[model samples]
Target chain A: MPQQVTRLLIVFAVFIGMFLVAAAFLKPASFGEYGHYRGNAIKEIAAKEIKFVDRKSCANCHNDNSDALAGAEHALINCQTCHGPGYKHNQWFEQNKSRFMRQDPASGIWTVDTILVRAAKDIPEEYKLLKPNERDACLKCHAINAARREKVVRQIDVTDHYDVKKKCVECHPPHAPNS
Target chain B: MDPNYQHLYDALSKVEGYIYPNEIGLNWGILIVLYPYITGLVAGAFILASLNRVFKVKALRPIYEISLLTSFSFLCVATMPLIAHLGQPLRFYEMMITPHLTSAMAIFAFVYLWYLMAVLLLEIWFDYRKDMVIWSGEKKGVLRLIYKVLTLGVYDTSPKSVAVDERLGYIITVVGIPSAFLLHGYVGFIFGSLKANPWWSSVIMPVVFLFSAMVSGIALVLFIYMIISWIRKQKLDMKCLDSIGKFLFYILIFDFVLELLDTVHRVYTAEESFDIISILMTKLFFTLTIGQLLLGTFIPLLVLGYFQFSKPKDAIRKASYFIISILVLGGIFCMRWNVVIGGQLFSKSFMGFTTYKARLLGAEGLLSSIVIMIIPCLILAALLWLLPPWKKKNMEAY
Candidate 1:
């Protein structure tokens, strides 16, 4: 190669060097360990804070609600589906449980491990989580549409079924709707 | 309503039949159309430049350097649309950093770099090395400094060295022809390889794209050459323009035939996807039938073919060529639009059709595309200033 060609080659070589440097630094640490994706990402995702705990956790406090939900048409649905992620409630209640409840001195040596929260107003607005009523949660799955197949989801024609102003919960208590 | 989703909401009202819920908005909009269109121009311009160096076509020599510059300038701006269309434009380098080899889309980054750096850049540099050395001394101020730096400290302009430069540049041009084909043909293949879309998937797609690319690239260079010469008040080289028209006419015929063959094949077989594709054709009638086929391809063939039989007046020839170039250029753009947008208009279900209303503003909109198209012209203007391809200037420099 001529001196000029050699100089051009040097420029190309420098570019190759830059790309290699970029590859070394910019590439995710766990990339290509198992395949094209970051292998460690799976572990990282697994380690993330839970936003939806098991229904068993919700069942621990609301025995009557759980019993109603289990015996009703909404047996398959979990508390978190309508109430939003229960993990946030668990965290907020654990931190602010003192405002909601305290161990009774009358109970003496046999004190309960956890207190049940009942009052809706005592919870802070930020930690209130979701308490969907009427159309908000029910209409999401039941709204009549051409694409929403009958077998996949039961469609409700909101206009024809009843007065448009009437709440669905008035006729059908979501926890025990079939009753 | 959120401005981002307004188009989708509007499209929802126009939705016909049973398209998927996800198919409401066109993901690959006008920017994607411009992407292949621009790349085709770059590859086509390079091929036209190759006609001078590799094929030893004497008539093409006048526009040869300009062709290369046009290729270089457009090639530089080619990936702008693809990058800007990205949702996370900042992370776009991830395609380069950890490019998935199996992906046709990811592979474009390498292909683009190879064409720009190895083929076009190297060829242009070698061609201009001796010129840079001479002009470095002949000029002053920033341009002098620019030329001097461009020379890369090699001041040797011996007959042997100049001979070497020409020989090497010739070799690069020969190498560049296939790379140019690969550059644009690969684009065609990207669309063709998608088996899901009956409109796009065809073996003949790559060939059609390559020929159309050549047609468009040649037309663009021809248009630029005429415009620049007219602007400078230089007498237009009728022979060069005539040769361009002739080449353009031939290749465009091939391009049309290949496209027709694909369409005819689809029609003849009338496979499972035939009905929806037929509907797609009707939907794209204005752009496909009028713009690309009638105005862009057929008329250029008629006029340019007429030129071959008899010598028209120089003024008439020039005006006809200018009009033909514009028509051909616009036609190729419509061709890309049809392929990219037309393929998506109909659903994979072979049932429904969706509408695509191109946004007037925003990143992937018509305005952005027009702005991107202008950038290449601006770059070409800058390049023409720095590397004057005027025969008068070349003689003056020598």
Candidate 2:
């Protein structure tokens, strides 16, 4: 081999060696352990507490609202789907449970304060609740458009059905929108 | 709804057409616009280099070395915008290590690496190795040490070895031509393959991108060459400038025609997306019509066309070329802006539109783009000082 070619080979080999060494150290610990991506990512995600309060939790306290929604158009929809996550609201209730309970004098029974529990409207800012009657919250599902299938649900063109500025809940209540 | 909720209702009222709730925010911003623009320059500069080295265009010889260096300088920063735009820039290397073949994005890392390592770096090294060896011997101090390291211990500058180097460099240029096309064409493919976007999903996207790359690349070289010559107190190469202008004119026409054809087809077909697309064109009337087509393309075309047919004074010709090159560059940037941002402007539902407002600061903002743009010029200056691509008396010693 020519002297220059030998030198070139040596330089190329050094570069390759450097790259391999760097790659060995810099690669993620769980990378390629199972598949191409970081295997630890699945566990990292699984470790997070569920943030959205399930429908059953909301229904346990608001049976009237749940019953109103049961046979309505949004029967399958989760409470947090539109109202936003309720994990913090549940946490707040747990922290202040004593304030929301008292002895009923007539029945001589200890009862939960329905007024404090039912007023989900006044949840703390951390709960990130969607304000009731907000057009965006309702339009997210109810806004009529050509994109949604005709058979899926009756879609309404906001302008054609009523004034563009009017909210869907103005005429139709959310729990029983059809009524 | 209660009257108290009117504030929220008013905010939602800004949306004029049907847009996917997710599409309301324009995900790709000015940074995405800069990605293709920077990459196009790289491809363009490389193609210009190939014209001189492989095609042996004698008039273009003056720019061959400079163009190669320009391509290298820009290539170094080409992926900066992309990496910065990523949510997790630290994991950018993951694309290289475990590429998903099914995704178009997965291919970018491989393509960028192949072009940078196999094509550009190798070609530049072969071209400059002899010079480095000579400079190492002639100079002293830090510069000498740097050149010595660059030589990689290949001190031989024999006629036979130089001939072999030339042969290898020529082969790389030949290979680089298509690689240049692939580099920018792949950018187009990234957009073109999106069946969901009517504006981007065109068969001629790669062709349009390739020709426009040529147009902008040629114009940039001509512009830079003129500026550099003036700064050095050297006479402008009128023949070279004229030839570049001629090439730019022809390629601009082809690029314009391809875009026009795509528009015409969309109009004639009048698909479900046509109405929305027409609205988009109207919304982009200033950018697509005035900035890109009229000012960027047509006016430059007419000026260059006149210059081609009639003999003008050297000063007048030089001034015209400089101004026209700037316009063409701006026009090409507008084309890229239209493709990247315009494609995302309208909702996938083909019913609504959103606006992109670039910030002066922040990660993907105007400030960052301005900084990104300046980085290449700085790299070019450094590369020029280190290698000095221009012919100097000391280079003859090799």
Candidate 3:
């Protein structure tokens, strides 16, 4: 090769070599083990703990709340859907059951911790249960949009809906929405 | 509320029709518009430069180096808008490495690098290598260091070495023509291939984009050529300016026709999305009809077309060319704006529309887009300082 050609070839070779080295080292550990994707991604996703504690678990403790929810418009909906993830909620309650009970065993009265429920959005990030009472909390799903079909979601014309001053929860019981 | 989204909230209240809450914020803002516009200039400028080298168009000889540097300067900053627009710019290398093979977007990193490293950089190096070596020896201090480093230790200015440089540069230019086409055509494909978006999806989108790139690129170089001559106090080369204007005129017509054809097809077919698109047209009346059509296409076409027949005075011709070049550049920018911003104006449902008001602040705002546009010119200014393409004092030294 001519002197210049040799130098150009070396430059090309250096780029190719760098690319090969980067390709080798910069990959995910499970990449290309099965196909073009990461082979272990499925196992990683499958191993994740469930966040939505379903109705059966909630029914064990709150019989009255479960009774109110049963056979209502929201009967099919997950309680955690509106209240945020319940894994932490159930775990917190399960672990701290004695904190809710009275000092006397016979006294069945229950009171929540004074530290909790001090503010409107008092529920911390650790325990994910929430009490959403705002108009937008309901309007997110219920507000009329061209994208939403009437059959799929009972769309409401928020402009014409009764009392913008009042929230959806003020008129209808959230658990048993017979209205 | 996050203070950054105050603009989006402001836009939301002004929205004429109902939009999905998600659609209230345009995911692709003005920064996205600049992405294609900048890249189009690169493709267009490279193709213009290649006309001189590969096709052996002698009239275009004057602006070849300038065109290459313009293309290079713009190309350097081409990815800024894209990276800045990205929600996570730190992980941009993810697109370079382990890209999703199926996506048109994922291929951009490779295409850009190939054009930059393989085509433009190589060709420019081969062209300027001889000059750099000479400049390194003559100069002293920090400037000497720059020129020395630029030469990459290649000091050969012999007849045989010069021949090799010429042959290699010619080959790269020939390859670069298609690569330039691919670079901008692929930019169009980024939007065009979206089956879900009726506004963007088209069979001729790449062709339209390529032609528009040519239009914008030629116009930009012509404008710069005039300005450079004025700055250097040299008599303008009328032959080169006239030829560039001719090419810009032809390309603008082609670009306009393709856009018209696309719109006519949509109007005649009266597809389900036509209703929404028609509404969108009314909303973008100023940008599409006035800015792109009236100022960008028609005015330049008339001015350049007039010059084709009549031998107007040199002063008049130069003035008209200057104005025409600016008009064509603005029109091409509006064309990109119409495609990117207009596509998102209407909801996917085809029953509602949203408005985009480019704000004066934040990374995703109009001010940043202006800054991004200015960066290329700043780069070009610095490049012009380092390697002035003007004829030097030692003309026959080589």
Candidate 4:
């Protein structure tokens, strides 16, 4: 019994010892570098290039559209909310300015790069640009549910408000939707 | 906008009611369903082992060792689905190292570790230690060395040493019962405490989970025991089988009643989320009404109840128990599915519903789920090979 107890202790010690050694190896080197989580994650995130260019950059080129949007009820909404991201569009224009100048309207020859247009079809759903005529774009925010939103400026239940197929832009313009 | 972008507009056209755009994609999938189901098995199997050890139910003696091993096997893989479901599985250790006290999720690492390391593993080691030591001396070659290593130098077969081992094992079993309850009950609390989701926010969630866990775990062990006995061409312990069936019958009744009560309360309250929930329930009619309630619970209950009252031949009883066990397992699994997946089907805004289309591939897909389910069975088979859990007479004959 004494020998058995001694053996059990030895076995338990070995198990505990192995566990500690494994844990030491498995633990990240920068584990406690910050606090609890791996500190390297902060560095990794910091190293990535910024993706969403702020609304201020869009105002530089399409000042008229920005001015119209700013005067509307949807003033708080960012330009990218409808136009999609401007970074790639801005980059394309900067790289291919000469192509924009070489277009001939009579011959229907436009040398402009397709990428510069920010085609809604080409982009992913998350970053897709909304056209002025798309009623669903307005409906994304305006589609009525008292349960979901706190202060709904105007809510429209699409089924009851108008012809089922009619676009919102047919009556209300996109830039100043309520106007 | 490009004409190709029309599909994006069409996507939202199908939405009948208002759903938060962010809520369109379900974060919890089939893998989350698996998490509770697996953990429930662990708790259930452990509780069954306690029936023999702590309660001293002599009829349950045969499955006592298998139940402990079954619990250990499932417990080992129980957390895999949880880790797999994480956005960053590599950062999972952070939950353990730096636990947030306010977060219900953070409690998981502690509860799981305590149950695994302290209760399940320790109890299993103590229970098997004497047998391992004996087997170590009796065997030769790789098997002998493996047994020797498992014994952990405890070669004491002395009556006094075994008495001490027995006493300690009893203590661990007593400790294990509550720990088992805590293990699965804590899982229930993780979902139940989410005040945002009306479906999961109920006090009865933990009780429902605990009883269902007992039902599933007992069913699994019962089925596995019957199958193993049949494979070995050994005489099925009718007494033991009947006792387990009886326990399963009683537990199933409790589980069914609690589930019905929860449903009744939700329907009667007619809360703001009630209408949407009603629609969601109708949509899930096949899985909830027919699969879980009818096929899984009620039918099995009726059959098991009949067995309780009537005296049947061993062959007939065994077949009935086997079929009923399978049904009970399916029923419990459906209950878990209903809780995890069904809870997410309705929008938190109480305005709409979304569908969960389980992918056949990917990390948390159906393929992965099937593979995960098979893994524990494989582990059990391996454990059985390493340490055969049978009586001395059966062992010698084999």
Highest TM-score against the true fold, candidate:
1
Q: DockQ of every model listed?
A: 0.37, 0.24, 0.28, 0.20
DockQ of candidate model 1: 0.37
Worst 10 residues of 1 chain B by lDDT: B389-398
Candidates 1 and 2 compared: the better one by lDDT is: 1
TM-score of chain A of 3: 0.66
- lDDT tens per residue, model 4, B1-398: 33443543454554557677667667899999999999999999999999999988989988987898899999989999999998999888767655667778888888998898778877877777778888888889999999888776678778888778778778888999999999999999888888899989999999899999999999999999988888878888899999999999899899889988998999899899888888988888888898798988889888889889996888899999999889888888888898898898777878777667899999999999999999999999899888787733233433
What DockQ does candidate 2 score? 0.24
Clashing pairs in 1: none
TM-score of each: 0.89, 0.84, 0.87, 0.81
Best by DockQ: 1
Whole-model alpha-carbon lDDT for candidate 2? 0.82
Residue B44 of model 1: what lDDT? 94
Model 2 chain B: weakest 10-residue lDDT segment is B389-398
lDDT against the true structure, each candidate? 0.86, 0.82, 0.83, 0.81
Per-candidate chain B TM: 0.96, 0.95, 0.95, 0.95
lDDT of 1 by residue, A80-134 (tens): 8888888877777667655655566786553323444654457677666676675
Cα misplacement distance, residue A170 of candidate 1 (Å) = 3.4
State the weakest 10-residue window (summed lDDT) of model 1 chain A.
A110-119
